[model samples]
Target chain A: MFLAFVAATLVITYFSARKSSGASAYFAAGRRITGWQNGLAVAGDYMSAASFLGIAGMIAMNGYDGFMYSVGFLVAYLTVLYIVAEPLRNSGKYTMADMLAYRLSPKPVRAAASLSTLTVSVFYMIAQMVGAGVLVRQLIPGVSYEVAVVGVGLLMVVYVVFGGMLATTWVQIIKAILLMSGSIFLSVLVLREYHFDLGEFFTRLTAIESTAPDGTKVVRNFLTPGLIFKNPWDQISLGMALLFGTAGLPHILIRFYTVPDAKTARSSVVWAMAIIGLFYIMTTFFGFGAASLMGPDYVQANGGTNMAAPELARKLGGEVFFAFISAVAFATILAVVAGLTISASTSFAHDFFTNVIHHGKEHQPGQEVLVARIAAFVVGALAIVIAIILGPGVNVAFLVGLAFAVAASANLPVMLFSIFWKRFNTNGAVVGLLVGLTSSILLILISPDFMGENAIFPLKNPALLSIPIGFLAAIIGTLLSKEVPSEDKFVEFQVRANTGLGSEKATEH
Target chain B: MNDPQPSAADKPPIDWHRIQRDPDFSALVRSKARLVIPATVFFIVYYFALPIGVGWFPEFMEKKIWGDMNIAYFFALSQFLMAWVLAAIYVVAASGWDRSERTLLAKFGYTSKH
Candidate 1:
């Protein structure tokens, strides 16, 4: 029933998107999006299935630390709000490639920026798709996993092909509101079940999980154990990646472009943070609500700890609540995927076709628009293929962590240095991006999470090692490089990016 | 074609010292900083400090709060409330800075408000 509603929603959204006028509309809702509207959309895009479902599940399982992911995610936007939001809105040409090319020659920088965008986007999409598969299978018990994947893929493509960013952003805005409302409603219901007595609730929750033969209390994993780090180090590493990662995500960064100026961009992050924070708080209740009310026996009977929150909802809210949440979960996945495809398409259209391939030569606006639409379809298809290969073995939440780590390691340093530090030359930008990307990937591959038979390395949690390495690499690379950019080129870039000086006469260079 | 270059004294032709002293520039910096600093501090604590607190004091965190809701649970839930407060703060603070900041940005070669 919920799938039917989402399919209908996607169809209507897709048709609405078909009216996108040009590349601007396709890429960034034609930059006509209102500040409030874009704020909701950004919240929607950033808050994925992992955030909505996984955070609650983790908290239910791991205790306090699992819920930390939610706090880290919301706080991460502070870094975005303070450092990157305005600069990105002030300086970006289109994709992040524009920012990189702003300070240096196109060549390898454009290529590298484009590559980085693709790598992060693909990983992100896989996590979303996998989450969709899991949710769909749960919602409709009889449906095969493969069918769920195909259904989600088709729905996503339909939305991206027709709606562009305009459709996608609105979908995100709606999804964000729905997701927040749904979680709050469920939390309220859960609280009501315990008569708002949280103390009794915890005792009951723990007592239920404490049923061992020897009476040894089996700590119901409220969140996956702090296997990553202990106390301060774990918090610091999570904080570093999440705090900085928001600014680096390609899709999130591009949302600033949909707004009017630096002020608007800044304002949007603040709004996004508030909306995101509210949702995270709601997730904690859902997590604990699941733990206290549903009990360990129910969670273990269903599957394991991950099912705690969802089963708790089933117990409290029953079938109707389950159906509503199931629909919202689908909407969450769709909105995020649509935004990702639009961002990727914009990168292809702006960075590759118009800028690099054409070498600043102007193409017909229609031709550019066509290319963007085509690229959206291509990205959606590629993500679908990746999702199929990943299959059922993957955990959606873990994959999201990987995406956050990679984005923090690679893009944050380059973007930050390019804006604030003048000495950061082209060579340094290229090297910094490469080092960040390589190190994060290397760390993830070898870590215990993705390690073992498929493991690329032996250590887990690369934050302590990889993050510093990336930052140092960027700083050192910039310091060692001697070739300063041409004064004239710098002046032109400054004029175009920083001032309202007359680049309005769009000339084919 | 080679263009004549300015001497060292003539370089940095704009009076940066005068610009710095301008009321408009000072107001611009003050207004922007108000929003930027609080937001930065919040990130430092919420993302950096809160998680560390929980991670370090796991035992204390796992204990119940109102009933079943523990300190960890409360922190996680309160986080979203904090985000909304920060967002509202950002809107009010950023809007105040917009006009003056724009003036500074123009002086520095600002373009494309859209």
Candidate 2:
């Protein structure tokens, strides 16, 4: 089944490669993806292996605290649908930078935006790559971690370098479908185990028996909060990160560009919210199902938290079902990484290489696309090497959290200011990006994740502090700068953003 | 895929200042803001309330409202419903905005095309 999925995706790449020509086609899939298709792709890109394997594992282990992650993830999309998506669709050409550079000076804004984009993407991609390596090594016999990392890296490189956004979109769509099906089926099986009784399922979840690390057997209620997150401030900080972070994600932002217009973009967001909301709700079943059926101790004893879903599948439906769920997890990683690669490469090539270096002028017609393809290769290889060096011992959840922290802090504040605040200037954009990016990373380095008991910052996530700092920096930088806000440009931007007066259109065949 | 004709960059610049001041545009913006601003604030408040409630008042939230289902679990599930409901309302509201956009574009002597 894994081989079949690989073959199917490669076939998709072949077809997309034939059709994906020109910068628009390669970068934005010719702006032709429909509402539901783009919706599925968006969900696919957004729902990484972290959401699937990690969340289930977390819930199986910690219960209600794990479900908190699901709530935050889904709720964050409202920020996207209402504030970010349509304006970004209307104002930006290819990247998140395109929207920022609309009213401000192009070169500096693009440069800062590109740097932040790459930072977030690399942080995110490394986590996924390491996850892929660890998962593949565990699931398949004789597959070493290094080989798995490199293999996944090379496959993502091929997808972005050749087929570009179109193939990546399809891969994500297919993966989303598979993931949804697998979750639904698994949830049904879980319910069947309880005779499809909600009362029975909830009863089982109330008193879950597990053994502690110190060899003491403990009985805990899985339905209660405070199992994993002992710190209220830490939970609030993580909540803020997730609540604001989705709007700032470069990969998710770029998915809006796949649709023809702002209306389609809006519809696509609605579709995605519905799909994503449903999928997350199902996480309740599978997550608690693993806890109730297999027991947290059993899951921990077998292969640990990340193996909760797959182990549940094996127990419920035997080997065949286990293989199917495993393959879906593999597809989930590939789709997410492919989405990340294209967004990073697109920003680097379009924003940095072409606009920053070449002064927004490609010396050759297809030079930008060429540079992006090359960027994909470089980015993929870099991620592979980093993941190998970092090894599977590095905490995947921490890296993912840090990525959200940076996005919420750096990318989001600047993006919101650029669109809404007429006073927002080049100085604000650059300073905001720098301050937000550095503060989040700096805070994390000193936080409990790295510093253990002697940590300077008590919070696990820094968005609660860094996000305010980001917004303040942008405001202060703008007020301090003497750069005259161009009223004409702001007017133009407002007109275009509010009404799709001058938006990118779908490419006709 | 062919290039977009009269792409935003190359198209003849419209009288953007006039459009910004126009009643139709102002109405559209006002209408969207009406739904969006309050909805955004409402959802953000509602969303953060969960963690705050669960974090600060764990004993209260731990009280089972249903068959072994605590208030925390029920509230978390309600978030999914809240998000979907909000999204549906926004989509329905935005369709009106889309119509206003079209009418405004037509008055400006430009045919809006997807």
Per-candidate clash tally: 39, 0
Chain A TM-score of model 2 comes to: 0.98
lDDT of 1 by residue, A1-509 (tens): 57676766676675666666665666666666777788898999999977876766666655556666777788677677766776566556457777667667676677677767877888888888887877777778898767888788777777777777777887888888888888888889888987987665556555436344475767554433363344466456656767666778999988887765565666677678778877877776787677666654555556344345556767888888877887887888888988888777777776777667876555575776677778878887788888888885565666777788778888888887776566777787788888888888888877767656675554445566677777888888877888886655454444333332222111111
- Per-candidate TM vs. native? 0.85, 0.98
Error of 1 at A144 (Å): 1.5
Name model 1 segments beyond 4 Å from true: A1-4, A206-235, A300-309, A362-364, A453-459, A487-509, B1-42, B57-90, B102-114
True contacts kept of 2: 0.72
Error of 1 at A389 (Å): 3.3
TM-score of 2: 0.98
DockQ of 2: 0.55
Under CAPRI classification, how is model 1 graded?
acceptable
Which fraction of the native contacts appears in each prediction? 0.45, 0.72
Give the runs in model 2 whose Cα sits over 4 Å from its true position: A393-398, B1-11
Candidate 1, residue A237: how far the Cα is off, in Å: 2.8
